[model samples]
Target: MGKITGFMEFRRLSEQSSPVVERLKNYQEFMPRLNDQEASIQGSRCMDCGIPFCTTGCPVNNIIPDWNDLIYRNQWKSALDVLHSTNNFPEFTGRICPAPCEAACTLNINDDAVGIKSIEHAIIDKGWEEGWVKPQPARTKTGKRVAIVGSGPAGLACAQQLARIGHDVVVFEKNDRIGGLLRYGIPDFKLEKSHIDRRIDQMRAEGVEFLVGQDIGLHVPPQKLQDEFDAVVLAGGAEQPRDLPVPGRNLDGVHFAMDFLPQQNRVVAGDVLSEQIKATGKHVVVIGGGDTGSDCVGTSNRQGAISVTQFEVMSRPPEQENKSMVWPYWPMKLRTSSSHEEGCQRDWAVATKELIGKNGKVEKLRAVRVEWKDGKMHEIAGSEFEIKADLVLLAMGFVSPVQKILDAFSIEKDGRGNARAATDGAGYYQTSVGKIFAAGDMRRGQSLVVWAIREGRQAARAVDEYLMGSSSLPL
Candidate 1:
């Protein structure tokens, strides 16, 4: 427990961000970390309930209250230890995770929830500043070789755990860089690339070999990995972005969110793009109003777009949740991200009908206001309209992992096209092929970064158990 009555005394304090005008000028993280005293006070607000719903709500099952108590006592290093005990990358989750743990807090029933994510950000930042983060090389080697495809959070987490257990781990990434999505998929403003780079260095120091530009089942065949390594873990993400199959969809200025976002990320990382999709001075229309769509809005604003607009197919959610009914769970409420705060007109229950273009380029978009009734959505009478649009970025999430690689390995896929693998029991994560296993988006489809980390850790434990008769790694 932190302070006995602190929950009643303190209110939640979120991380502060720069003003819209200033932050939109460049693609950089604007949220400032809390000071030690402020973080301690926030931590003290923890009620330390008997059953921590935050732990269950969090995908990785973080030990929330203990770390909060540790921070309240000014035990920064101890707080870091407790955080690292469960989460392999608290730093990543600290920045990008949506913090479902906060929604599930008992205090959120009647009062503001404890600033768990803010405290985590402060703890991990302090750990790095104090040089507490370092490579933990295994004392002995188990001599089992593992081949991991993909360098995203899941693969990275799995590799780190296996390396600590003395496995000969080698990760293969298609991109020139180590981090798959973290390095490319996510925009740099939300998450800087240096974080991934430093972690890659730490893993390298821990004896994990990373081979970039080595795409498994492409440049190198899956059969080679089967022959060379004791086991293989597929952690590649679902890259097949859902397309908007409308008229003039093939026109110039129409692009995928992943395509546009990654180009800017590469540019931020000092790579000059050959076919960069820029929103500079263009009237940008973003499709799909999730994190990816929000990201497009942010990026377009940064790139000096004339105007930005977002569209969501679903009906608008309530500004605030009815906490009486949805307390201790993620509720259906309106979420306005920092990107949204910058400036953009947002519309709900509007569906894009067609991309109206001329001269082989998009010039406008045709859409219609829709009504939802009896579980079906239909267009409202005479609600069809058109809007000026120079660019359209589809952020409608991913459908499945790239089928080319899956087919190359002859891996069996579920109905949803994700790799078919169970998440429980003695031989979980094992694919149809005996030596091969799958985890993260490749197995479970698109999900939060925290869920990917959890799957990676669990898959690592499963792999460890499979390799050595049993595993002592945490579930």
Candidate 2:
């Protein structure tokens, strides 16, 4: 659609990452952006196929082909408009999203995807540089107030949408900062806090008030919000981290990944840590070979760890996916993150049996290689071994949202312990309580930031319609 023969003319060009040695020195963004011309060439590779499976592949249902075509034609402003129409924060998704959209791109079936993610990143970055990104205050005031709990991506997106619709919105966060997980869980190297800061500034300019250090269900009663605001939206993240309940789980050097990651992030933000968990000079063993574990590896390397090792219970994924069979859908395959590129030993099909330590501190990890047969994991005989470890970070992921917080609201929960809410049909996202609503991880459980944004925007529409009997906001 862009160049007619663009797909045949141009090949995919991805953003370049900084050299591993240089990037590992400090916690900063290392991905180098593409020049405008280079980005255009990549964008032009989009075929704009009739099916356009990339749209469905993206969690936010971004208008991928339209923007790709616009970018290829050097219509920067129009491309930005198309991008902003669907995703409130293309910048965030462009940087950290897994980009399943590219995986599902028709071009990917035969060759590389059109470098869609990089093109998107370039477009948003350009928009910001050109001062084209600005606050969009509602033209008319609705005079209705809404309270949003948790200022993570979900709450922030919901508040932004509600504010854009002329509703008075206030986001309450328990932490001292506006961003929940984004400000804490993610490292500064991956996503600098300034990105979040500027967006918060924009939201504030749009009439969305943020209240940091305000815990809705804790210090401030949930009933208070319901009474003060016309409607209340719950967007608290699922933060109950899954832990390894092994013999030495209670040891001093062992900790949850959430507990460990936030401290490092805070320290990077120039906050003085009283008791920072440092991997300095220690042999670090990170359990769970997910993104979080990879993050730990990077952080530990930065901390000058003697050695870093990551463990995964599941069998290793294939080096390459059978594209013919899994095209247009996310396929399981081995993924090595930038952090992994720096340094670390990754082991799969290995389960930690117990933590061994002396003097009440974690010292070693005892594990065994496992073999799967008939849907069961069997430990191999004589496969047990011990790895030296002074620190252990459990990054197995989250179990559910903090139950006590939800319990404070007396909200009904789904079988998964998330807030019971529907996303389809009219009256969607309404909690058991008449005036209450739910979205994001609190409603759908732990998920990607893109999914949270989608849920938040949709829930905003639901709440808006419920309040005024009509809504012009897009779901």
Candidate 1 error regions (>4 Å): none
Per-model tally of clashing residue pairs: 0, 0
Write one digit per residue (lDDT tens) for candidate 2, span 1-475: 8587888887777788999889878999999678899988888888958999999999889999999988888999999999999899888888888898999999999888878889889999999999999999999999999999999888999999999999999999999998999899888888888999999999989999989899776679888988899999999999999988788889989999888889989988889977899999999999999988988999999988999999999999999999999998999999999999999999999999999999999899999999999989999999999999999999998889999877888889999899999998767999998889999999999999899999999999999999999999886
lDDT of 1 at 306: 95
* lDDT tens digits, residue span 66-174, model 1: 9999999999999999999999998899999999999999999888888999999999989999999999999999989999999999999999999999899999999
What C-alpha lDDT, on a 0 to 100 scale, does residue 33 get in candidate 1?
81
Report how far off residue 43 is in candidate 2 (Å). 0.3
Instruction: Highest lDDT: give the candidate number.
Output: 1
Candidates in order have lDDT scores of 0.92, 0.91
